[model samples]
Target chain A: MTQIVRTPHEGPRAASAKRPGRSAVSRRSVTLITGCVLSGMILLLALVSLFWTPYAPDDTSGGRLTGPGAGHLLGTDKLGRDLFTQLMTGSRIAVEAGLGSVLIAAVAGVTLGVLAAFAQGWLDDTLSAFLDILIAFPTLLLAMLIVAARSATLGSAVLAIGLAQSAVVARVVRILVKRVLAQDYITAARTSGTSWPRIVAGHVLPNIWPTLVVNLALQFGLAVLAEAGLSYLGLGAPPPNASWGRMLQEAQATFTTAPAGALAPGVLLVLLVIGVNLVADGLRDTLDPATGRRRS
Target chain B: MTLLDIRGLTIRTTDGHTLVDDLSLTIAGGERRGLIGESGSGKSLTTLAVLGLLPDGMTATGSIELAGTQIVGAREKHLTRVRGTDAAIVFQEPLTALDPLMRVGRQIAEPLARRRGLKGAELQRAVARALEQVRLPEPDRIARAFPHEISGGQRQRVALAMALACEPKLLIADEPTTALDVSVQADMLDLIDTLVRERDMAVLFVSHDLAVVARVTDRVLVMKDGRAVEEGDVREIVRRPREEYTAALVASARRLESALDTRRAR
Candidate 1:
């Protein structure tokens, strides 16, 4: 057997040389790096807030309406609470909501999507119609209703946002799965005597994962924004917990007098959302077959 | 010993459009047969019916026996067992016939593991041996590479290795070299012919190209519009085609070959 196995010198070298275009690789890498850095900074802020803060987030000892000065990093809010501590804690809340909701959306959406793609005739049509109906209902409004009904807490907000986002994820997943199913390789796998479940595990899921990763990253940003909206409306995370949306709502009245109070949470919220969007953009560039590097 | 026996195999859609109309053929053990027809001539449908892989809403009627086992209307569970073990099919487009994301070795190993229960060192050795049998270079490296990592000819070879891995009694090559270049196509045809001879496997080679069908197959079946118009020895049919359809096909193929030869001479 060893003697029979020939070494073809020309083939492998030619194959390996077929790398992705230079411009495409560089562009994707730049996007991926920028996204990573921005998201990493937000995550770092959240992690740091977990251990320590500049001052007690709820403490009202600092002078009310003071500017940025010694002992006070971002000055104080109208109620004299440490502005920096509140902003840092708000970062943690944003991350939690983003991750939790995205998790929920992924699991439920992927299952429903796969089922719809595999189903035939009426069942497929019905699943697609149901998802369409869900998508038609506005995400924020749906989250608001769920939060109102369930008593707004971190868990409820996460659940509400996740359920609202699942429809969009499901739709994308269904389309991706349907496209993959139509490929010749799937037919080949079927002819190879591989069972449906095994084919899905071995072929279907792996092919669709890159697209799903990119879509889910975009959903993460959407999830964060939705959670913040709910928090601003006083239907997310409650008062005791520092949420960026709630901080923004609280700083609205004192906006003219103390600019930093409104600016601190607002700036951090914008940065985190931008960070997530950049990550999604980078992921799309990296995972897309047309843009990404190929083994050949 | 007849390896496959099909009698009155008619395939039709739910809307009652007949795709394969009462087609019947037989292949004995170690026999090599060619199914020659144009696109939409039901050559693929007939082969797919044998493997119980007809598309949704298409129903296959009449008897399809493989080693005396009924295949038409067989349950999916039983058909799956018969499929990579009793008979295996190598499709036309090597580019798409393989899972792009999966390593070639694991793709080949999957059926072997499922059909033969081979695992660990035994599985690895079996996959390497299969690759070697197809005359692919560096079996270990090729096995580790993804489908897109190899050239078209190499990919087709991998596909052959996968089909032959189970050492099935019957091998169905459904226009397996049609998607390859002219030079590579001959090499693939030679590989299939040599492998079939070595394994003593009954082959049902389907192709629209008369030249390719003639090169590998000993017996030929000429099909047109879902019907078998003629069947005879490969040489006899090519030399003196009985049916008008087969004669036309032979004439066209000859014309094309002669035209190519003239161009080469120029």
Candidate 2:
């Protein structure tokens, strides 16, 4: 017998050493940290807003079109409601919409994608074609159609955005599943007497999860942006909820006198989206094995 | 008793082009048999046919009986049951054969759990034991490591461990050592040889290297163009190949061995 000797502790160190060069590693970490911090700040603001804001989000106690002062940090809206309070509440709605839509997209989209990948012959062709048609339909248009069909409520907005986003998720998942299935390990799994369901749960999912996770992160940002767009169109969360999109719409008429009303929500939305995108890029760099890190 | 009997096996594409035509072979219990040929000679397809794992758009006809269970035309459900229990296969590329994301132990334990119902401590023990059987060092550590964490030779051994974990009556190894370094290849063949004898498992060893086949197998079948050109005892065939194709294979093996010998002499 040939003796095989290896130190278990060396395994992890060796793996880390094989990662990309120092500069690349630092860059990825910086992006990841910055994204986390930015998103965390907004999430914190949203969570804190659950109990208290400077004033009630819909309270128009301050004089209409008032500028920033000790009493009104971001000034008052056209209706004299606290802009700062509205921005905080808007963060809560944005996060909720992003999370809810992504949940729907991940579950429904991954299922459809896996199905399309596994289905053979006509079924696969049909599902692929159907997804193609859905993809061709613009996301905003689809959300509008669904929102128009249903009442303009938070649930409807979430459903509309999620349904529109699922097609994109499904298409991505299909390609990923196809790539995984074509690998020799899949063939090995089949020959090992592992059933298709077991193989999917055991081998396929684990292999594709990292990539799917990065994609879902990107989708979360898009979902938030989509929800904001819908709300701007008066189809998102109804009044009193104070989503950023709706706040933007309401602030449009007062842009010249009290620009803080529009600027606060708009900046927060952009920051949230940018933070999420940066996180996705960082995740892609770390999770993908192809981008090997070189040790100095 | 014959561990595996394949008769009149014919695999053809959807367009009706024959990839493997009318090949027949058998392996008795605990026998080590080899099928040797160059690439595209249908050696791999013949083994795949036995497992009912031929790729899409290809169909196999005739009978493949594994321990008296008919495999051809069998339902996928039934074939699945027979696969890990009655026969298992190891492939050419170990890197690709094993799941990159999974720990080696989990991959080995999967068959043991599904086929033998081994669980918990027993399952871990079985996985470690399988690794030990393949002569891998530090079974526990190796088990925890991912496929990519280990060396190529170690990965191939892990693949062998998985195939042999269930202690199947028949093990089909399709060029299992072809991807390994030459120095590692000899040890791999020796390990397979020792394990097959110890477990009394019949192995259907397929390779393009004549010398490799001769080392591990007692009976050798030389194939060309999807057909078995010659079959006989290893020594007899190596010494006096009857068919022209078999003769060419034997000659090549001799020339390679001599070339290695000359380098050693220097």
Candidate 3:
């Protein structure tokens, strides 16, 4: 019996000769590297804080407004808490809430989005109506409402933010799924004797993953900013616990007396948010097909 | 005796637009029948309906039988067995027909795995043999290469290999060569014709190109307005076409060839 097969070529034969030095760098590389360094530093701080801190971030010092010195590197806050320790400890709250909220939102959104695209009748109508309702409210206000209604804890704040942001993620997923569903490969897959489960798992999911990854990264940065706003407004995870927003709240009163106390945590918060946004932008550039290999 | 039969096959979109209407055709064992028509003449739609592959929102009502088994309007699960096991289609635009992300060899192996329960070494051996039959260079390498990396001609051959993989009794080629360059189109047609003759398989070769229909088919059905207006032996239909539309199509094809001849002479 004769058999049918296709010959495969190894290592991109088309890239021969004229293509030189594949390590060409892009501006995105710089952005990505800088963002990665900032993110890694924050994560390292979180890990270290779980075990120890140089001084208690909430402890009062013997005197007021101690300038930078060996014992107090970033000086001290109004309560005489070590500025360096408070910033380091605050890393846990920022990273966890931002990462956790976006992850939850992505899971809920991607599932609903794919379902809305595939189920075109009453199911589509119902899901889309619910999505519209979610989108109608400002995400921060919705998060605030949820947090206000319940005890404002870290878990509740993250859950509220995730639920509030899910509508945007779902909308993006739905549009992408609709595009994939229209492809000829999908039509061919249906006629090729492949079952729906295999089609969705193998074909649909892989095609949508790049889009989902970029969306998740972007939403994480947004969540970080949103979490900070909540903390500043006193609706964030309540403390003796350190958060950049709660630190900012404390800084507002001491802005006139010791500016460095207000400025230190505020600078760190901006740096973290900038780092996240830069990473998201880099990921979008790299993952997008149109601009993927332009540097090379 | 006929191995596959279609009688009074009609399809209409949900918007009440008729795509294929009262179209009937048949293929006996080892027959090579061509469905020749202009675009929108329902040749492709007729085959899609028979295979239970019309897009969602389109409704098909027809009696279709394959090797003594009825298949028209069968639920998707039942149709799955029939698609690659009993009947397979080689679509137009080979680039789009095969999955872009999958390796060519693995795609050929899929039907065998799904329909016949073949796997592992047996599956690999079957895939290697299928690639060899399609005349692809370095069958092992082609199996690993993605669809986009290969040339258009190679992709069409891969599609042919896939259609022949399951040893299906009936193969449908829907404008299989419409997307290829002229020289490559001739090669693909020859490959398909050779396979149909060797396997003794019934083929529903659909195309808008009358010359292709003439070259590859033993019998021809000329469709217009979703219905077959002329059906006869390929040579008879070409030389003494009964319908006006069939005659016009043949005349236009001859004119096209003459124009090409003039351009080549220059």
TM-scores, one per candidate: 0.94, 0.95, 0.90
TM-score head-to-head 1 vs 2, winner = 2
User: Model 1: per-residue lDDT, tens digit, B5-108?
Assistant: 99999999999899999999999999999999999999999998998988888999999999878998789888877877789899999888888778999999
Where in model 1 is the C-alpha error above 4 Å? A1-10, A284-296, B263-266
Worst 10 residues of 2 chain A by lDDT: A4-13
Query: How many pairs of residues in model 1 come into backbone collision?
Result: 0
Residue pairs that clash (backbone atoms under 3 angstroms), model 1: none
- Over all chains combined, what TM-score does candidate 1 have? 0.94
- Model 2 chain B lowest lDDT segment of ten: B181-190
lDDT of 2 at B194: 81
Predictions' DockQ, in order: 0.51, 0.51, 0.37
Candidate 2 lDDT for residue B61: 92
DockQ of the two-chain complex in candidate 1: 0.51
Residues A1-296, candidate 2: write the lDDT tens digits.
43433334222335564556778779888999999888989999999999999998778889898899999987888888988899999999999999999999999899999999889999999999998898888877877777779888888889877877788899899999989988888888888889999999998888888789888998899999989999999989999999999999988987877788888999999999999888887877777554443223
DockQ of 2: 0.51
Q: Count of backbone clashes for each model? A: 0, 4, 13
The lDDT per prediction is 0.87, 0.87, 0.80
